[model samples]
Structures are given as C-alpha cells and as structure tokens.
Target: MSLSLFDEPKLDSHCHVLDPARFPYAPDVAYRPAGQEQGTLAQYLQVMDAYGIRQSLLVGPNSGYGLDNRCLLDALQQHPDRFRGIAVVRNDTPREELQRLREAGVVGVAFNATLLGTEFYANTDPLLRHLADLDMFVQVQVEHDQLVALRPLLERNGARILIDHCGRPAPGGGLDQPGFQALLALARTGRTAVKLSGYQKFSTQPPPHADAQVFVRALLDAFTLDACFWASDWPFLKAPHRLDMGPLIRQVEQLLPDPADRARLWWETPRRWLGF
Candidate 1:
C-alpha cells in the first residue's frame, strides 16, 4: 500500500491514437471524433510520460477510421517498442493482410459488437478461426446480453479472447447478469483475458465507480490477477462527460487497494501479455 503507483512502469492495455491531421479520417466512416475525442500521438505520449507508462496497447477506433488501420499501423511502425496494436479489420480480411499487420506490431484484431451489433459479425467464424490460428487475439466489446450469442464463436477454434471494458455491464445489472456471467465463464478457456479498465464507460456512478467494484472483485477471483489487466481508454473517445487519465489511475488504487495486486494489475500482467 506504500507503493507510489504514479511512478510504476505499466502498460496501457486499451487506448487509441487518432491523428486526423496527419492520418485523416476515413471519408466513408459514419462518425468522426472531433474536439477532445481526438488524440494525436504526441499528446498521448505526453500523458504516458507523465504516468511512467512504459508502453501501450493501442486499439483502432471504429469511429474515425472504420476499417482503416493506417493510423494505428503508423503509430506502431513509428514506435514499435513502445506500442502494440489491435486492428479493426473487416470480417473478410485476407490472411496476408493479417500477417502484414502482425509483422507491423499488431497482436490482435477488435470486434465491436457493441457498436455494429451481433448480426453484423454473424459470419465471422472463419475470420475468428483464422485469427486464432495466427495466435492473434480476438478483442471484443459487447454490452448487455450481447455476449451470450457470441460466446460460442469465441469458443470455436480455440480463439484467444480479450474482453474489453469489463463487458460494459448494464447499470445495477448485478453480478449474475448473463453477459457478465458469460464473461466470467470465459476464464476457463485459458486463452481468454479481461481488461480491468474503463469503469467510466460502464459504471453508473462517478469516479470511485462503486457499482463496478463487485464485478472487478469477481473478475480477480475468476480470471485471477494475471489474466486481468489494466487500461486507461485514454482520450476517452465518445465519453459521456469529462474524464482525465490521472483520476482513472488513482481509481485503480481505490479498486485494488493492495499494492501487490496493483503491481500485478498495472504492470506485470500487461507486460507479460504484450511480451514487453
């Protein structure tokens, strides 16, 4: 408990680099992250430096770039050692492209059933299986009971699963909520992990995020400290209100008061997962 986490070397498991000025948003994309939602690499690095974050796992945001991962790839290529990425690829993406992305420092691909809906990804089994074959993670973001239908697809072909934002459970949904339960059941797969980050995304309360504490505890019990990692979801795209990285970091302290648990959650696990 004496640890000063502010200086701890940690890996941000979920974040994005949106440099629209240099990278440009996809014209056909449905949404563009203007204003505070957009974060250039320079700004993010400043935040990272402030927090002593040694590295980050950047996810391609579906908002600004859609299926275009150029922005994500550029950041990875520019700082290969400091960043690894999860790209957003079409379900029909070719194996060669996946390989190319892998070589460029993409360890995985993201599926946003939370935004695009479950039916949009109904026939993604082949892609999912291929990603599994490639040893790349299938990072998923789903809410409510959306995970129930996709659980089987994740299980198929022994895919490496990484659930985002603590499954973004419905407020007051309780620990037994089917989607959250399904997320917990995924722990037995061994190939699965969860990011114990982004309470602001799902929590009904402000900072302390009291309602999410029980779920975080359950995840620690089920997925254990190793498979459950930390993320800031920095720049906090599409956030409902104002957010800041410094406060979220302190919130982790409140959630995992044990310094040992904080050490593992913030540093050891993500470093191991990303092979840093």
Candidate 2:
C-alpha cells in the first residue's frame, strides 16, 4: 500500500528543523551539516506532505542551539498542528525555566550523550526525577555500549526512555550483543521506545546492508510495534551519503510487512508515545 493512504495519523517521532539564520551552528560543533540552510520547518513540512506525515516531533539539534530551545519552541508555536518539540537542557537549569519549556509544548527532555559525552548528565538524578514528576519522556542518544552501561540507572528511574538510532549497535554484533540485550530488557519493562532511523549512521556499509536489516528486524521483534517509533533523522547529519526521508519511510514499510504492524509503527505507536 502507498504511504499516502496513511495521511491522517502518520508521525515522524524524531527530526531536527532549524533556521540557520536565527540559530547558526557553533564553529567547533561536532557533526555539523554541510550547509546549515538545507532543512527548515518549511522544507520538513513539504517532505511530510509528500510522505503523508500528519505530525512530527522536532528534536533539539545538538550541534547548534545548545540548551537554547527558542528556535525549536518558536517552530512548535508556529506550526502546532504539524509539530511538537523535545529539548536539551543543562542539568543545572532552573526548574522554573524547564517548567516554562513544558508550557511551550516541550513533551520530552533529551541527553545527547554521544556527542556531549556521558558525564554531561552524570549527576542528573534530580533532573530525571523532575521529568518523572512532569510525566515527560527522557530521550537518550547513546551508543549500544553506553546503553548497556547505563541500563541500571535508566531502569531505576522509572521514567519513559526513548533510545535513538536503533541502539547504534555494532554491525557485526547482532541483537544478542550485550548492548542490544540491555535494550531488549528495557523494552520488557514497558518503559522504553526505540527509533528505527539513522541506519546509515550505524553501519559502515551503504544502504540496504543485510547487517543493518538484521538489527532493525531484531528491534522490531524485541520491542513489538507498540513500543517502537520510526523517523527520517532528516538531512541525515554527518552521514557519508545523503539519504532521502521518503525512501527511509518506504524502507520501514518493507521491514514491517504486516499491515497491522505498519499501522502501529507509523500511526498508533507515535500517537501514544508522542501524544499527538
């Protein structure tokens, strides 16, 4: 079936849209996009329309606008129907400011540990507790190994956790690897969700690599459609090759061949997790 038919309820659970003119990237920021002007809310909406995406969650870009969510928040206000936001904040940020961000349609808090380093939120128990109190989800961008290391702390917090990029498991490691095992264990607790995006970022091989497929299928099987979400990871940051969001969405359709599974991955699950 064509993705157009899924128009009414489709959602991209993770994406980054920024107006570089307003929030330009820092010179030293790692993984900076080739040209800052490639993606914007307007461009993102066009892609969404083409692929029948009704709504999307705008995740804070780690490279630019570090802890300054105004750019994303503004986009959310301007296109409330088509977007929601997840923000990255300093562990020491005032509670009042965080509360204000929540009022601004910020549904979740993100820790970009892969780029910022794991110690960035090391003493973040209080922040995690605050999110739990607000009933907000916690988004983590750590590789599989890091995930395995942090599994205990994440499970103990009891806050809903969203893992980025298929756990970013090594290409040869397979799903039974220690990191993936930890992710599967977290899924069993019914408090975690994973994004089936950025396969390019995880694999050394090019598109349609069988190793990448192995990891994707493992996640789909381990978490079930209800606990999974899909994204374009649009603009494909720092990727060696350019990726079209449209084809990625189509790839997801192929991966989850069951109509019911597609419905859950593309529609039902996002609505529940992103509250759209």
Candidate 3:
C-alpha cells in the first residue's frame, strides 16, 4: 500500500500495559512507577488509533511484574486482532505452559539481560529448542556492550534474535561504541533484528530525542530494511518525562524518507519477525 504517516496501517513492535489490580505486581520487581494511572491497554489503544497503528506487540513487562504474564496475555487474547504478546518465562518453564502461551497469541519470549543475567542467556539450548518448536523469536533487552558478548551465542543457537532499543548503545556513542559495532556486524548476518524504538530509554537529551538518529541511521545502513522493526515503547514508563506519540511517528518518517523504507519499518519487518 502506498501511504504516508497519517494513512499507513502500521505495527508497533513493542509496547506495554500493566494492571496491578488484576495481576499483582511482583514485590521483587526491580523498579516501580509512582503512579497507578499509568499506561493501560485502553489508553495505549487510543494512541494507536491516533497514529494509525493497526497492530501492536505487547511486550511482557517483567520489570514491574517479574515473570507474571497474565496482564499481557489477557490483552492478547482479548484483542487478538489488534495485539500479540511476548511472554517472560524462566528457562525451566514447562513445555505445556509454553504451548498454552502459543495458543493464546504469544508470539515470542523475552529475556531481560539487565535483570536475568548472563547465565540465562548462556544456557539457550533448551530455550532455543522450545522456541524453535513453537516458531517464536527470542527478544532480548540488553546493554549495548553485551551485544558483542551475546552475538556469538545468539548466532550459534539458530533461533531468530531480536535486539531491543537500538541495541541501547551509550547515548551519542553511535557507531564508535564497540557494542554498537558488534550490533552492526550482527545485523549483516541477517539472523538479527533490532527494534527502532526506545529512543527515550537511551537518550540523554530532552524530549523529541533527535540525537538518537546517529544510532538509527547506523541501523538502517547496516541492516536490510526487513531486519529492522519499529515500536513505540508506549507509556514510556521509565522515561524522565512523558512523551507524545506524534513526534516519534514523524521522526520515523523523517528518518526514512522513502515510503519503501517506512513500509518495512512500520509493517513488513515487524510482521515477518513477530509472525503478525
């Protein structure tokens, strides 16, 4: 379809929703947002509608709720057409449980290296096998530097590897950072896909996050258009300030001047990578 930002039916490859009442937040969660009226599914959908985002992938918010995926799964099941989910499960989680998740519209499993540790990533044989059996990707949220150390292991395993938040390079480090360089090399292999998202997560500057382009451009230059996905990281929970969706959407369009590139970023790549 030939379209611009206002008309294109897009897919937000990453976002979150939390309902503390239905699914209690884990006490051991690393951090908690102060407000209860944070991003809920209904609020996120409103943003999606405003942006013409036809579909979204609800990433399991492990930070606030540990491994509990009920909140994410419920949204997936309740709104199958508009959303899919990535669940957070321990390496030892039962196969039957995974099978159930698959049936419930969970397209992948997420690993938070920032919290789960290198050991969790190191022991991937079983997890990879299970994910392969389910035809799902392994989504990793890791420090940019870890991309170098994690590359060989992720590549050796043969399952699809999705890197979160533009490989999360040091703010302004761009291609010079060793980890980002490793990420670029990984992209060339075609087994890896990086999310064009979380601008707020890694940016040191204020709103609009224009400086993040140094990394964004490097990703588009290194990876095939189909290997890069776009996301809102909606609700922007950890950000220093709340963000509006319009500017980010415009930023993506500006970064990808050609409609073909925007198509891949907004829909094609995420569709292929997430089984949408």
Candidate 4:
C-alpha cells in the first residue's frame, strides 16, 4: 500500500519538550515560555503519534531554562527509546559533565548565536574541541551576518555540526547574502548538516513561505540529499504567530514532491545520523 504524507515514518529532527511545571523555568531568564509555547513530553508524544513521527530530536531551549537541562534529561530518561536530545550548556562546563550528558542520551550541545549573539560564544573554542573529542555535534542557531563571524571557530574544531532553521536567514537576504552563502559554503566541509526548517522564523511570506524555497533548493544542491534532514520547529519558540504541525507536514510534501526524495530527507538521513 502507498503511504499518505502523515502516515510516512518520520523523525522530527527538531522540537522541544518544555515542562516548566516539573522542571521550572530559570529565575534569570529574560522571557519564559508560557501557554502554547510549552509542549511537555506527554503532549509531544501525542503529537508524534498523531503525525506518524517515529522519534524526535529534542532540543533544550535557552529561553526558559538557561543551563538547566533537567527537563530535557528527564524526558530522555523517561522515553529513552523515543527521543534524543541537543542540550544547552555553559561554555565553561566541564568535560565530565558533557560525558554524563552523553551517557544520558544527549547527542550534542546547542550554540544559540541567534538568541545570544555571536559575541557571546566567542570563548567556545575549548567547548568545540571537547565536542570534537567526544564525537558529538555542535548544533548552532545563528541569523543574518552572524554566521560569518563564527565560521572560523566552527570549522577549526572539526566537530560534527548541525545547523538549525535554514541558518535563520535574514529577511530579504536573497541567495547571495553573506550569512546564507556562508551556510552553503559549509556544505563543502562534509561534517556539516542543516535542519530544513523554521521558515516562519525567517520568511517574509507566511505558511508556504514561497521566497524561502530558493534557499532550500540551494542547500539541497550544496549539501546533497544525504546530508539534509527535515525538521518542524514545534511549539515554535518566540514565534510571531500561532502555528500547527499539520501545515508543516503539508509544507514538506510541497517542498519535496518526489516520494523517494521525501523518504531520504524525512527518515533515512536522520536515522543514519541520529541512529533512530
């Protein structure tokens, strides 16, 4: 039998499980995710089942939790078979702690240069080296011209890297923009991968995000199908408007019309990279 779009097996390469009630938001955070921005593990699982997602790569957000990875760890421990995680940690965090996180099902650490700015991660070389030694990924979220500043640091470490949100390209920044071009250039490095997601974060147009398609095509051509993965930035943090998973799934169908290509981007690539 042929499969429907939602019925096709998928691994959500990006999403979050925020249980402020159980884990509590950090006191120092400038903004706390409330209401729909929050999606607990139980809730996320229901969404997964609803959408035919086999697993998810849970990312720890810096907004409400800061360095507190307890919520993410709790979810990973509780549902070890269903999810892996990307964490948020301080630059000075010790190797021992990273090892502990690795043992706990964390696959990488996130560097949110978009939310915190490139300057904040200037001292991350040691951390990057630690990740390289550990064979873990350095997942980055940077926007606009920010990537130009961090390219040297990211390339030198040789840690396997995952980029978030199509580099969160700056609005009207076209194909030749320095930051997006920098992202495409990373494709030559062979150790890099990008989450083909977050159109709402970067696109000037809504939903179908027609303008962002060019960037997607450029990335697919640059990184090749094997190195690209599909992601829905679920319960999308700091979003300017409400969004739903259904439309995102439909968007993927439109993005890659061929069943064979969708199979690679949606399931095969992530399964190989994350061992799902």
Q: Per-model C-alpha lDDT, please?
A: 0.88, 0.78, 0.81, 0.90
**For model 1, what is the C-alpha lDDT against the true structure?**
0.88
- Tens digits of per-residue lDDT for model 1 on 1-276? 454678877789999999899988999888899988889999999999999788999999999999899899889988999999999998999889888889899999999998899888889888887897788899999998899989988897677899999998888999999999999999999889999877877788887688888888899899999899899998888777688888888888787788778889888988787767
Candidate RMSDs in order: 1.5, 2.1, 2.1, 1.0
| Ten contiguous residues with the weakest lDDT in model 1 | 1-10
Which should have the higher TM-score, number 1 or number 3? Answer: 1
Number of clashing residue pairs, candidate 4: 0
Better of 2 and 3 by lDDT: 3
Candidates sorted on lDDT, descending: 4, 1, 3, 2
What is candidate 4's lDDT per residue for 122-151, written digit by digit as tens? Answer: 998999999988889999999987899999
Model 2 earns a TM-score of: 0.92
Model 4, residue 68: distance off in Å is 0.5
Better of 3 and 4 by lDDT: 4
Give TM per candidate: 0.96, 0.92, 0.92, 0.98
Candidate 4: worst-modelled 10 consecutive residues by lDDT? 234-243
> Candidate 1 — number of clashing residue pairs?
0
Give the winner by lDDT.
4
Two-way TM-score contest, 3 vs 4, winner: 4
Q: What is the lDDT of residue 275 in candidate 1?
A: 67
| List of clashing residue pairs for candidate 2 | none
lDDT of 2 by residue, 1-276 (tens): 553444535788888886777667656555455574248778888888878788888999876667667779888899877787899888876667778888888888898777776766678887777777777878988875778767777777777899988888876777778887888788888878999887876787887545688888888888988898988787666777757765676686678667677788888998888777
Q: Write the per-residue lDDT of candidate 3 for residues 1-276, one digit (tens) a residue.
A: 565576687899888897776677888888764574267777787888888899998899876877889889889878998888889998877668888898999888888876666666777677877776777778988775877777777777677778889988888676788988888888766668899898877888877777888888888888868798888887777677667778888887778888877888898888877776
